[model samples]
Target: MKKIFFAFIVTLGIFEVHAQKEFQGMAVYESKTSTADMKNQMGKNKEITPEMQKLIEERMKGMFEKIFVLHFDRSSSVYKEEEKLDAMGGQGQGGMRMMSSMMGGGGTFYKNVKDKMYSVDKEFMGKEFLIQDSLPQLQWKMESETKQIGGYTCYKATASKPVNMSDFRNFRPKDQSKEAGKEEKKETEKKTNFMDDFELPKEILITAWYAPEIPINQGPENYWGLPGLILEVSDGKTVILCSKVVMNTKEKATIKAPKTGKTVTQKEYDEIVMKKMEELREMGNGPGGFRGMRMGR
Candidate 1:
């Protein structure tokens, strides 16, 4: 029995190698984020009632649940959101647009494992940016646990990623004391602006599941470097799961980098976004401006 099991493993390895030589596939992933934490944070505000909270959750559900497609070959992949019509007839169009910009959505992400590089075509505040950067190096800890996704056997891997300060999903409301001295409150208000009401954690844990049968080291979004093709990923707040996979389709997908924006590196892009947010805060905090407005309110 031991020899048979070893032989089976060897045979699977051989098949995986052969598949990798000519594998080309498209995978559909359904992504959804849990807004429970955000809601709880916002619940601190006395202005929000139970009905208001429910309404907010409903709107956020529509904004956070999304579909994405990953077009991948052996060494490269292109991941992007699958566009869909708004069910509310564009009622919350502006909110959706803002959420997309804040979450880094509606972009073309191209990754080249062979070159250890990635390129993203991102549009923020009506400006296009081509962000080119080296792929992030993650120290993945592989686990002995196994599961099945879309009929493929998968293994578990986990890694820690630094939280991006600019990502609004990572924001948490600041704790303020209502009983502070008037002088202290005035000093705090003078030193800080609306943007200071939120803070981001230092890091987030990323859990992924990869299927060795796929024989490609690719994944949804910026995750990769596993022994196989990643089929699902969870970062505590959001969960991305593979719903369907089409292997070796008749129409091959074009896996090329985008080139139609102001070129910048990842760091530069983040700085640009931060600068823009600061500008908005200044504009909104001026006389008769959009002040005293909390996020997600």
Candidate 2:
């Protein structure tokens, strides 16, 4: 009955909001990065060859260009990728696995303002993890700045958080992990072997522009708690910007939490990933003898 009622409401173009003119609809975001900027960031790296550099840059441009959708009503929203198996220029898989996690890649994100809880589907080392966590409380400072994105007037807000290199890549470098473990620690403190190995930056700042006209506090990937719908988000190196919005359209969709993964809180998921990654590193480090012993752990 509830589903039928929602269908009827969608038919009438009304769901939750009383103001018919107000937006209770969907927004499409195309996340893009400046290829030139990426090429520049890579200029300092010693690992990429000049020939490999050209191929990798083209691959980066092809891969990072993505589409995300925001299906929002008054107080709830679900953001996910619009699936497309893009051509990767027929390039072979590179030395590293996908860096999508750094890109905030494919995850069904469900947010509820009333409940103040969020869930994300994260895949790590062939395991799908359902991460349930309390909504991040961001201390945002709204500015007098304004801009127009996809025909909507937007206001600016800024916040910052600590960041880590592992947060951007699927796996931590085996050498980096070893170095982190060498640091001394107090035995009384909970061991950070699985946790502290990855190095983190002092901070990452987020600058987002939201549309007050829309009035939905939602945005791509874990960014929310704003007064309006977030249209563009920047984290220094990457940016997710809303390219299109369809207000009150007949595209039938529902926002729901994901199921059927190893259910875990965010902290537990991180620990599990580290344990698996360590196993992989150890397995690769071996004559298959010490590797087997470590795997037994």
Candidate 3:
């Protein structure tokens, strides 16, 4: 009886050690936006022929489809795009690179749920910015819906997120009422500003599917605050889905937040981007630029 008791105590100690081990995981996600709407919108334009539309579609395809990897521990995670070479063996096309900057791609995002803060290393128009901000408080409404993704059972949760009007992904064709058409004609007569017609919805609904078995509150991009790890997210136009998940890899990921670049809050970062875009527009309109280029014609 004494020998059996000693063995039981040793077994319990080993189990405790295993239980205390830090949990780590890596998730690969494939993000893609539906181009059908964009194509349909562009098809209405008389200037864009079928061949030109196809070329634009191909370019936009590269901009919309991206792969991201999330390396996460129990309390923190780092998410970044998986770099890939372009067709011509260079980094990417100039147009694609510009689209990436406009879409805020190619950034290292770090989130610490325990500390209730997040940081991002973003480069825009040749300027690097470190955006440090508090985690957004999403009032998620849990649903009874369930689905299987990559062999894991995921539950649905949803919330409303404020839309950024400047994001091209959120752009929708505005309904042209008779009164609005008259106003638009008047503005056109006055040579309306190129940026005046761009519009996006005020708010967007976010749907996320989280896997409770993972038990981490981390997610791709700026999404979080769920009871489990978010495996998939959709914001109407774009969908990010987990393609693979590996648990407890041999090498633990370094989950340090980015420290370089000009530090600014998220709001300030948005303001800076908008201001720069405005400046560029002014420069383009000034001298020997793409002066006739306009949106919402």
lDDT of each: 0.76, 0.66, 0.75
Predict model 2's lDDT versus the native.
0.66
RMSD (CA, Å), candidate 2 to true, equals: 9.4
Q: What lDDT tens digits, residue by residue, belong to model 3 across residues 1-297?
A: 999999999999998767545668899999888777666655654445787667555655666888999999877889988887775455344435545645536778899888999998877656778989898889999999999999999999999998653356776546657347477565456432323433577788999999999888889987999888899999988899999999887787787899989999888987886676678666754101223222111
- Model 3: lDDT of residue 58: 60
User: Mind giving the per-residue lDDT tens digits that candidate 2 earns over 133-247?
Assistant: 7887889999999988988899999998555333542222235455566555533454313223334455778899999997777888778998888999987656888888877
- Kindly report which residue stretches of model 2 are placed more than 4 angstroms away from their true locations once superposed: 1-23, 34-47, 86-98, 164-166, 169-199, 274-297
Better of 1 and 3 by TM-score: 3
Candidate 2: the clashing residue pairs are none
Overall local distance difference test of candidate 1? 0.76
Q: Please state the error at residue 198 of candidate 3 in Å.
A: 4.2
Clashing pairs in 3: none
Best-fitting candidate, measured by lDDT?
1
True lDDT of residue 233, candidate 1: 91
Question: Which pairs of residues clash in candidate 1, taking residues 3 or more apart in a chain or in different chains?
Answer: none
Could you give the candidate ranking by lDDT, starting with the highest? 1, 3, 2
In candidate 3, residue 256 scores what lDDT? 86
- How well is each residue in 1-297 modelled by candidate 1, as lDDT tens digits? 999999999999999988875668999999887766566644654445677667656665755888999999889999989888776676646545655756646778999999999998877766788989999888999999999898999999999998765566666545556334454665544432333445676788999999989888889988899989899999887889999999997787888899989999888988887787777667654101123222244
Q: Model 3, poorest ten-residue lDDT window?
A: 287-296
Candidate closest to the true structure, highest TM-score: 3
- lDDT, model 3, position 267: 84
